[model samples]
Target chain A: MAFYDSLFDSLGLREWCGAGDKGGPMTMAELLAKSKGTTATEETSALTLPFPSLDNLHAACEAIPRTRDMTSGVENFFLSIKSSLQFVLDPLTQPLSWLLDGSIWLFIAMPWWLLIGITLVAVYWITRSRASTILVAVTWLFLAFIDHYDYAVQTMAIIFICTGLSVLFGVPIGIAMSKNDRLQKAVIPVLDMLQTLPSFVYLIPLIFLFSVTESKLYGIAIILYAIVPVIRLTDLGIRLVDQDIIEAANAFGMTARQKLLSVELPLALPNIMAGVNQTIMMSLAMVVIASLVSAPGLGVLVLRGINNLELGVGLVSGFCIVILAILLDRVSKATLARVDVSQDS
Target chain B: MTANVKVSIKNLYKIFGPAPESVLEHAKNGVDKASLLDQHGHVLGLKDINIDMKDGEITVIMGLSGSGKSTLIRHFNRLIEPTDGQILIDGVDVMTLSADDLRKMRQADMSMVFQKFALLPHKTVLENAGTALRVRGFKAEEADVEARKWLDRVGLAGFEDHYPHQLSGGMQQRVGIARALTSNSAVMLMDEAFSALDPLIRTDMQDLLLELQKELHKTIIFISHDLDEALKLADHLVILKDGEVIQQGEPQNILLNPSDPYIEDFVSDINRSRVLRVRSVMQPLKEAASSTAGNVDYNDTLEDVISHSDGDTTKVYLVMHEGEPVGTLCMKDLVRALVPRVPSEESIRS
Candidate 1:
């Protein structure tokens, strides 16, 4: 200790010690006096520390305002922005509202059963399995028996729009996150919040922001609720690319842009496609919840059944949702399987 | 062939960190290795590496893992940049080149093959080979034509349409070799290119590389941890240990007389008779024709001498160097050279 003391003294470190004291521990007046090398005058008023004393904690608590709401500004800002967006989108949402309306004329214009048959056949061909194809056909026939086919198509339409939009927006964002560490850090906490939030909670604020009659009101909510898996999986897919492959690309003198296009993205395709499948399934899950905000779907029949205590209507609509889930899951999974085979070969 | 230097590196250093400039500043002030490890925690990948690659010569960098051989070779095409030194391709400093110029140099003057073959998994063999040319802005048809030619050269002519996963390890490596050769770069950097293949396939690949080297005369820098592979292919060998050059010379010279104890230990178990050629040890056949009843090529191995000769006249043979007789060695000398030396009793007891 003495040796260290002498070493510090010889190095003129005592001044640095005092400087550290001023920064860390010393009182402001003491620090000021040390800086100026002067004492306080008799007439100078004493300066008090800003921190409350332990003995006076109860008094401090009593003195502070109880109604000091800290999050008021944040809440107000969010509310205003949401309302303004809804006001701007109201006119643009009219055609979608009319499309959602269940009229005889619209039903006559489109033969519902024929459309169902065609969709089932296309799904069968894509999935390349008779069981899944027949399952889809029978499910649709049951939906028609319960007069929920039209409502089921409405739900499917919403799911198709939401899933397409989710993949389109989510994949690019995921890729961007994979490429940029700072962006990944920024996005991960938000993804965590979205994934953990109750699915029904998504519709609560949107309902206040937009009218229940608009299709996009629920459309936006369902997309927000379901888009997380795709984005996360895409990021994971790209990140999971073998580092050796990346180094090889660099050795080949491929630019960063070229490597991403030719190597990284292609290798990550299976994971990204898996993410898309998850997103589609999630979109289906959110559709029933979105029906609370007047989303026209098989969900409407389920809601009606629940409201009226009709067991048959509820069971039929629930079965219809299951059939749709299987159809989408089969098609997406098959596509992914094909991609993997191609990549392996 | 005229001696043309294809690649030159001078005192290259690579230190990884966020503040490379500050890290380098500290590193220049004679910071000891342990202290640098303590302060910055940088894995000193390559340190003060200087090498020159000649045209049409296969230079092998041999080292254990973490010896910086891969990092050192990667600096040639700017795959990894040197923290301090200059890498010159032809007459231009690659470090100072513009991005476009670097890409052009890599695309036109240099190519690389990786240990894992690094073929694009989704693309067919033809597409993988053609990717470099396509990136270099060649038209699809022209790129395909050139790719097919190189594929044929690597003996995978009919398998162009098969994807990488469809090919065997040997076949995939062939595709990798083809992809590299397709660029038509005078210099090719192969970083343990056949290390992942089975022994038989590895030998075949080595033979293929030798065959390709003969016709193209490409300046090649090969990296390997395997000593035998280095001896088989390298015109010049650089042995690295703990991020420093231990020994560097012709493969025959290094194999015969390693410079230090570390190098000696590294080369100790090597089959010297197989690696050391008669040209390295044989006395010239000037006075030897009258002395010995039989003729032996100066380039034959000592093993060959023992295996081929029969009668009692096999007492001593003169060694040759460049058509001039250099030294004389008898049957006893051959036995002495073949046997490993045992330590004396005092050394053994210690």
Candidate 2:
């Protein structure tokens, strides 16, 4: 540290690197020592550094930045911007809460049989198979028989709202990305972070920004986690369209909009549908985690099961989530297969 | 025949890299293709290309792969913009056309057939054929009626409702041609359109194209890597090597008098007797030669004349065109013309 002091001093960096009181949270060791109102015990080391080590550099030059400082700096920066973010994000996000709440109410108010009938009809229409329709019917009946139909509907409502929003916003973003290299370069890292970042890490920030009572808290968290796949796959799908086919369209003198509509989007449908299926499954996965923020659903029952150690409640609710996922997956996959068949034929 | 020049490309340079403009100077100063790429990290796609495509004739651009033949064809439609050049179509500079005008030009003036067929996989053959019309804002019904005519012309009438994948490769290419024909543009740009077909199918397509060309008389720019295809289809031939025009003229003239070693190499192994037509080697005559073996069609290949002669060097046949004697083809000159003027290089690789 004495060596670093002289080293930094000779380089004319001492003014910034010699301060002791940078206004921020202290390191864990400093915090602990202060809380105990005593200097922490130090063990003398037999081995001595031949030169200035990083620890001594931090000690002897208190202005030298530490890793914690950088993290807390990011935290402080977010805290400063949080109100403006909420101001902008809150009004924009209010409709999402309404959509979620409205869907949940609509699902619940309808008699269970009517909802099941509509769902079965929709599935049968899309898949065009009586066996799949019967399978969906049996699954719904089992949920009702177990008295978890209401909870199951709540989860489906959330997934429906979130996945719909994801596709609605995600698709255009994906299209824009596919059209522009600069935008794709800008979006890809953000998408990568959203995808690979631990789901709860994003929630930590969202929890601070929005209250648990706001439906958008869970909605936003679920969307942030679930939207990545659709956006990624949509971009990939558009990019994967045959260059020769695109050239053919261009040779016909297709305008940009005409080409996108009649050629690119139609060709990319199977991939986009696959993206939606993944988004639905991911939304279902995030729904259980979203229950930690007071999202009402079968997830609530599962959490209650976990907290109270009731194995039966957890297993049944978990099974219900699996059934919902399978229903979504099968319907979407059937639609994808249909598209493929039509294109292939 | 004094045909009007339909499409004229002049002083075109295309350098394929980040800074094509900066490298254009070097290319203009006679920096060859490989060294320019090696020194400046730029690919010389085309260098000072100049060609006049006459109306109502097939101008076959002949080259092996990576010879800028595809690049040149695309420049006509601005699919790949030239680094520097003027493309004059009917005396209007294509490079200076506004975006809307360019699209208008492509829609109203030209259509293309692609090597891989490039048919829209999702669309039925009818819809794919109607693409140019649909893009031009024709309603589906209107486009359908128009497209049906071309599809019928291309011999795919009953297959209108079928998807591209459901058809064989030859059938798919017919749909490609139908799509081009349906556009009804005067210029047809075929970029290796039949290269994907089997050899037998390719010859059939060639015959089909020639038959259609005879009836239509549309200005066509056909790109081919195969010399035989070029000789068969080209009314005017432009040979390319290393992104430069090595030689260009009538295909038979190019065969008779190849100016570059590359062009010479290209024609070296071609079935010379089969490719050389009687009209190319005939001595112009106001009357039939007094010596009489028989009469031969002006368009007949020397192979036909050779068969007619029965290997007799003294036979001379009257070259007939439209039932009139235009010239006389002497077996002695034909036999001498069969030998190469210059000895070809040894071990010509493929």
Candidate 3:
């Protein structure tokens, strides 16, 4: 270890240490530190790598042209393409913006009693179990009493829109990927980079391209971060379709489009729905992170808690997020269960 | 058309590789499947296959695994493309059809029953049975009615709404058959269609298929690895080995006069008495305007003829079809047919 440290030292990275990149650009390491606690000192952060020589490695990372050049290049790339991308994207994303804005307004403006009553009825309709439905009603009422109703409602609105958009585009792309092997091979690595990149890394390029004030900024981040599950599961669902079944469809003279609609999509519904459930949860996960970009709701409060170190504010909002997750998860999962039961019968 | 030849294969070859077209010359020149793969990178899936399937007959192609029997059947619907071949069905070359024409060919001319009962797990049995019609733009109600008729025909009338996973394997295969029948296509492809069923259920399905065939008279092409199944279902039998048809004719003829050692080995262990029809062994009609001990149908198995004769050696029987004399069968010829013929080569060598 000492020999390796000395060897790295001779590479002359010492000058780059403590250059103080104080703009708070938020590295993947900072995200980790944020998750643990928002109060880790800069000195402690230099210990991110497990090895003893990580101090030198950190300084070397800043000095390394490969690392610095790539990061800055990516940000610039996103910035340069912003205008054209936004133009092409606006029409496609307008519906998404409308859905997000419309839903948020509707959720926030509804009376507390009306909202709670509607939620209860919907939950009962799905689960048909008085017990689960009551649990839902009580959870919502608890939020109302705690004065977190608007925040919870705001979070739900974002989740609903982001997940809806993710499924809308993700399923067809996944189906296309399933049909074409070359496309699947090419697109899978892009999906992998999207998924495996640090969750916070998604916001950086969008922040550079779209102003922090734009609703589309966080909306895009939530979708890019959350859409992976539905795409993966939809692809898996279609690919896992029985080859013999496919041959039978072919033998029966089904056109490709007919086969997809009648056989592949129907058979793949359960897996796709499961994928939707995960996408919804992932959308919620991006909630607080997305709040950093001026997106509203419970996440804003969590960010407030972190910035001001207000334990009560952070913990309360975190509790509301959990409540929202469990409620959304239960509803979608229950619906998926119904689909599975119908399949079995 | 052309003496009732429903489908014809003309010098078909299937070489599985990136450049099967480039290797066609070698495969055409009798390069064996093994050497094609070992010497070159191509796998010879089928080689020089020529067959004529008549209308209203079950043409059963029999081969062990990797003999390309399955590959050959798939070519009828163009599910598997051939390297060099022409497949003409009903006097039209299927190989030349456009995508829409090909789809119409499959929808109007062919339907298939699978070995594993490939019923959609999500759709109800009725919906599955109606699938072929639904694909052809039939109204849901129209398709359902058509499917229900065949479902009843296949003895699955009341189980329409049940999903596939709810049914047993045998019952699931019944749905597969019902689906094929519901399509009302001129051609039915059964790729080892009964090979996956229980033994008792397999026999029942076979009988069901035969009963349906007698009434419908569809041009059926069946692929099977089982010699017994091939012998039982085939009206025109094509025996395949290593992607080549070794010998094919009436099953009884192949059993009686195996052209080579490979066929001899195939028929050697077969119970010939159960397979050989009396017409295969009966003497051509000699105009004896007289009565015989009994009347036998031309399609009667030799076993049935024996039981009709009641073990009497002197009894002579008239082989009839539709109450008309086709041939004469005596007890002597029946007993001789019971004995397996020793090939001339084997006898000479011994």
Native interface contacts kept by each candidate, as a fraction: 0.71, 0.80, 0.76
Every model's DockQ: 0.41, 0.63, 0.49
| CAPRI verdict (incorrect, acceptable, medium, high) for model 3 | medium
lDDT of 2 by residue, B1-350 (tens): 32599999999999999999998999999998889989999999999999999999899999999898999999999999999999999889998899999999989899999999988899999999998898899999999999999899888889999899999999999999999998899999999999999999999999999999999999999999999999999999999888999899999999999887777777888889999988888899966478778899998988988887889998888888999888888899998888877667652554
Ordering by lDDT: 2, 3, 1
C-alpha RMSD values across all candidates: 12.8, 3.8, 7.1
Point to the candidate with the largest DockQ: 2
Better of 1 and 3 by lDDT: 3
Candidate 1 second chain TM: 0.88
Per-residue CA lDDT of model 3 for B272-330, tens digit only, reads: 77888988988889787376887889988988878777788788888888988888888
TM-scores of chain A, one for each prediction: 0.70, 0.87, 0.76
lDDT of each: 0.77, 0.89, 0.85
CAPRI quality band, candidate 2: medium
- C-alpha TM-score for every candidate: 0.82, 0.91, 0.85
Task: Please report how far candidate 1 places residue A105 from its true position, in Å.
Answer: 10
A122-181 per-residue lDDT for model 2 (tens digits): 888988877778888988899999899999999989998999999999999999999999
